[model samples]
Target: MASNFAAPMKVIAAAFEESTGHRVRLAFGSSGKIFAQVSNGAPFDIFLSADQAKPHALLNAGLAEPGSAFTYAIGRLVLWSPVTGRVSDGPGALREGGYRKLALANPRLAPYGAAAVQVLGSLELVETTRSRWVQGENISQAFQFVATGNAELGFVALSQVMKEGRIARGSGWVVPSSMHRPIRQDAVLLEQGAENPAARALLAFLRSPRSAALIESHGYQLPVSEE
Candidate 1:
């Protein structure tokens, strides 16, 4: 959850730890990558993915409990840049700048990347920035590319920069949901994780009101409770 779920997870973990004194560790990566790791018998108790596909893969592979998978949040796309003077107020900013490199996670692996492509297509900016594009293996790496200035700007999860209901002091545009599909981030308990109580605690806390508030503070829409 740390890429799509990164900011929200941090905020929620703080409240969870403060209230229960139990720590939750974060491992951020593309759902595909993490799912692959978990399938190989990795000791991960809980998985929060940028899409439902990875969790579905886990279910198919007999690695995750079928009944336990649930959506945690909705991810939004952003056109973000680390440049001092370049400002992005919409998806059109890609064409309006002097940027030579824009990074994104692999669309085939990360839902955020798919949203980025959809935004570019909607704005007709994909061809303009195609040659200058940088692809990260995953969403976390894509964010890092822009964050560290390795790429002038990148499509990243809003969850990365928004915390406590405020955006960080960097120029970017939050793409409307009409621009792309909703990033229905899904979570599941792994068979490898059933032995770990921390994972269960983490999942329960994620659904609690306190954690829901923290997730919203980081720019992700709070999940509708599962019936």
Candidate 2:
């Protein structure tokens, strides 16, 4: 699972375990890192990527079961700050330019980071803000950087600071989807788990209405077809 999905996946996995008696052991990290590990024969049964590209790459490389990959969630990006009004105006706050450090995941290792880069480019702040960056290896760490006041504000997954359509703490501005490509997160059955009933069952659970609602409560959108 990608680190951005950490909170929701944990809850979903626990619910699946309780209802089906199937224990799910999950490992979360940047999609890029996990993709490399999967390609290198990491012993993972499933791949829940932060983008469609990685899963598609795995399928093309014969690392994942053909036809098993599909979008599970559409992630939202947000400009956030732990301070009450730091980011209330969204990109406007960024444009105001008083903050010393801005945190974001490393674009090479996380889809959210790639989106953050896109957002910066769209806002025309790339050159001006690039020097103040505090890059995290993954989105979780980026969020942590802001939450701990290491960075005044940063780009993070909306799911990290939201629950049930509300910001859980601090302030945030949901980035407009038009600013970047849709964050279509995909999930696939790895070749290693093609014959694993538990893996298959877990995948089925992700597509269930139960999981769909649970996913939305964490501030993610379902694929249009599911919606």
Candidate 3:
């Protein structure tokens, strides 16, 4: 699972266990790192990636079951700070460069970080803010940097700070979709778990209305059902 989905996935896991009597153990990290682990024979039954690319790669590598990959959520990015009102100025804040440090996930490993870089480039602040960058191994750690004041602000997933369609604390600007490519998060059942009934059940449950509501409540856009 992607680190940004940690909180919501916990809820979904609990509900799943309660409804199906199947316990799920989740490991959250950057999608790239997780993909590497899966490729190296990690015991993960399902791969919930932060982007579609990794899941597709796993499919092409014969590491995941065919026809099992699907977009689970569309992520939203935000510039957030634990301190109240620190991010209200939005992209202008980045251009003005008042903050000493800005945290973001590693672009090489995390899709959100790549999007953050895109945003900075769009605002023409990439060079200006080069020295102030504090990169985290994943979005979760990047969020930790801002939450702990290690960085004044960070580009984070909206799911990390939102609850029930509203910001839980502090303030942030939900970056416009036009600012970057769509963050289409996808999930796949690993080939190692091809015969795991629990894994298949979990995938089915994820597409249920109950799970869709939980995912949307955490600020993610649910996939439009074809039917």
Alpha carbon deviation, residue 87, candidate 2 (Å): 1.2
Encode model 3's per-residue lDDT on 144-185: one tens digit a residue.
999999998899999999987888898898999789888899
- Candidate 2 off by > 4 Å: none
Over the full model, what C-alpha lDDT does candidate 1 score relative to the true structure? 0.78
lDDT of 2 by residue, 83-195 (tens): 88878777888889899999999988788999999999998999999999999999999999999999999999999999767998899999988999898999999999999
Clashing pairs in 2: none
Which residue segments of model 3 deviate by more than 4 Å?
A: none
Q: Give the higher-TM-score candidate: 1 or 3.
A: 3
Q: Looking at candidate 3, what is the lDDT of residue 109?
A: 84
Regarding lDDT, does 1 or 3 come out ahead? 3
Per lDDT, what order, best first?
2, 3, 1
Q: What value of lDDT does candidate 2 attain over all alpha carbons?
A: 0.93
**What TM-score would candidate 3 get against the native?**
0.95
Q: Which 10-residue span in candidate 2 carries the lowest summed lDDT?
A: 82-91
